[model samples]
Target: MCLLDKKAFVDFITTLWNIWNYRNNAIFRGKEEDARVIWERARKLNDDFRIHNFSIWSILPWAPKTCKWDVIKLNVDASMKANRTSLGIIARDLDGFVLSGKAIFINRVVNSESAELDAFLEGIWLAQSLNLDKVIFETNYACIINHFCKHKDDITIFGYHIKKARKMLDSCSKVDIKWVDRGCNKVDYSLCNWSLSNCYNLSVEMDYPSDIHNLVISNVI
Candidate 1:
């Protein structure tokens, strides 16, 4: 068949050996073989080997960093409960100092994707209201980031909000929209969770409420 890199070739050979062993067991030893289980085992084996030997994760661990000297980093998240959705955003400067943060409650029911996009839109507005000239908007939802990356003339249902966000972003001197894993977005998650229960459309001070102290510290540290 096709040639592969050294690591891929080794993995391929190992998977083939495992499959051949499975076939032998099924035919001669009368053992049952599950395709799903075999494939999962092969993947797990490959991943574990790479993790231990290659140490890839050790090089690029998930730690959200501060923005550039002139840019503010905004983390936004949405949490849905029954029919209502809570949107949260936290803005921090290059020194990890809080700039502005908000927790808003939307009174209507919306799908998770829409909720995420709505939260993102709120973040853009929040940045604009604070007169932030440079921004790096970060979200945990990869799909929403992809939505922003699409063409400006997109005709999808969420295109309106995306277009508005892009327009607001254009006003900024520098703007970046990026996706981070959930682990790196805890501050936004905490803000959304708090908003769902306590703060309904409230603007938070730099020294946020006592409840969010740990979360803010964790992110800054």
Candidate 2:
């Protein structure tokens, strides 16, 4: 527990639980479960248990309000330290259930705004990959969202990236980008910071294998 990192720690516990479960099933039910199936099931339960408090928060009166009915929101953030950049993307349904999330790490990228833009684009791609038709992409950094509202030439590298982001947004049929305050987006912000320090890259489908969820509990509480 003290030595292992977050992801490794979560996996260790989940695997233990699954092994105990497999033992009981074999003894009581005389069932022999496949090893691969057991491992997959353990992975699925990782995030479900990791940030179980989030589900509790989802029902809280103070939980961040859903912007529009039936439209999912993707909260994204990024952190840069030295030449390391990390991007975090997390999705929530209208009802506040955490739909999915990702933590990505990149090397040799030093700019903060560039990291922020990268995170925003990753959020968009994740939502699209999930086949979400209507998504409200959000970031806590106001400047990036505000910058997209204007028209600018691709004179510099940042400008070129901005143009690329604009084109990506334009291609989306029903995607909107907005700036939310950081307090409301603490979950992804925590994830981004954690990824920066640990260089952890992860993706969770609705729920699973998200070490960030564990990182999030410390923030919300």
Candidate 3:
């Protein structure tokens, strides 16, 4: 077995046990109030138990602190149809050592042109809200990126989204939009799948998917 600190192992087991018990009582037994009480009691017990041996191990840090680079990765993908299309956006802070925040936006509308525009506008709004300065916007659609960079003004159907994106771009100090292979954009694809599965609602600052999380961890290390 892999060696682990005895105290740390015990603490992990205890926390897991407490979580299981709370879930069992609340969800399985339908005793939500009692479960809440038990959860509070467990929290207090854990806190009291650690009072004597206070150590950094007891603290659970969700995001690592060593990450110095903050890069925003924005992606857009669309599913085309004869008369309609579906669009998706995945905007995330891809940090080297920290757990990044994610935002997913999706919509279904008539035509791929409109869908691309919507995705672009949504990405801009997300970047602005997160105060992202160094953005690396990516998409599987090379044509869209090329058009945006070349300042193509003839895309009337997506003109508004393009205009808004341009305005947002002007506000940012540094921005780079690029095209990546579809196989390399799994996180963006997952966000699209998730959006389609959830009926096109908005998910902001959601948990990263397992595959994406694993990829990020492996890369960071």
Candidate 4:
């Protein structure tokens, strides 16, 4: 859904929740001042609601307030130089469950920054091959996400990958690239670490992790 639609829907639901909660509170017994205060609070929440339309609360209202995006497509990999260069990419589709793919490129002269760019490029390529036109492309590396959407280009090492990825993206219909908190992208990070340890190219599919799958189901409902 678009940002405006998401925001409007969330505001309506939050207002409903507020009304329901206040109806159950004995303290809300038609006191003019108390009622005014409650109304004001609701109004304030509506304003605050505009700030995070993409948050999980906007979709799964009945789930815990903390529950957020239930499904994610993630790519993880790393690069290093210990007398030799190594790079890898782990692409995962997570929805209440996890499905994954991994790739390793040895002697690639990639650093952490380049690895992140490479992972995103590889993820986009995979998504395109799968015909996932509207999939969300997320990364913990803010710089990479920024670059993906033509925001800024401060990272010099991954210039080639960036250019190649952009050319590839031009052929896709719609791809939403976004920056996510590192904590939320832990699965991808783990895959990256695994690739580094194994020092081999890896690609496979995995079942959706429970938390992510549940989140997806909740959103659909």
Number of the predicted model whose TM-score against the real structure is largest: 1
Q: After superposition, how far is residue 192 of candidate 4 from its true place, in Å?
A: 1.9
| CA lDDT of every candidate | 0.79, 0.75, 0.61, 0.57
- Residue 51 lDDT in model 4? 46
lDDT of 2: 0.75
What's the residue-level lDDT of 65 in candidate 3? Answer: 31
Which prediction has more favorable TM-score, 1 or 3?
1
Model 3: lowest-lDDT 10 consecutive positions:
97-106
TM-score of 2: 0.59
lDDT tens digits, residue span 1-221, model 1: 36788778868877897798899999999997788888788888877776676545453354544433478888888888867788888888877777778888777678888888888888888877777788898898887877788847578877767877788778778888888888777878877777677647767767677667677778778
Q: Evaluated with lDDT, which candidate comes out highest?
A: 1
lDDT tens readout by residue for model 3, 34-149 = 55666677667766777555565556444523323367677666654333345556665664332233334334355566666666676777677666667777777766776677
Model 4: per-residue Cα lDDT over 148-172, one tens digit each: 6663553554565676777776754
**Can you rank all candidates by lDDT, best first?**
1, 2, 3, 4
lDDT at 57 for candidate 1? 47
Candidate 1: Cα lDDT at 41: 80
TM-score against truth, every candidate = 0.64, 0.59, 0.53, 0.49
lDDT of 1: 0.79
Model 2 agreement with the true structure over 1-221: per-residue lDDT tens digits: 79999779879988999999999999999999999999999987875665565734443345432334367888899877778888889888865567788889887776777778888888878766666667898888876766666537436666677677767666445777788888878888777777777887877765555465564454445
User: How many clashes in candidate 2?
Assistant: 0
Better of 3 and 4 by lDDT: 3
Better of 2 and 4 by lDDT: 2
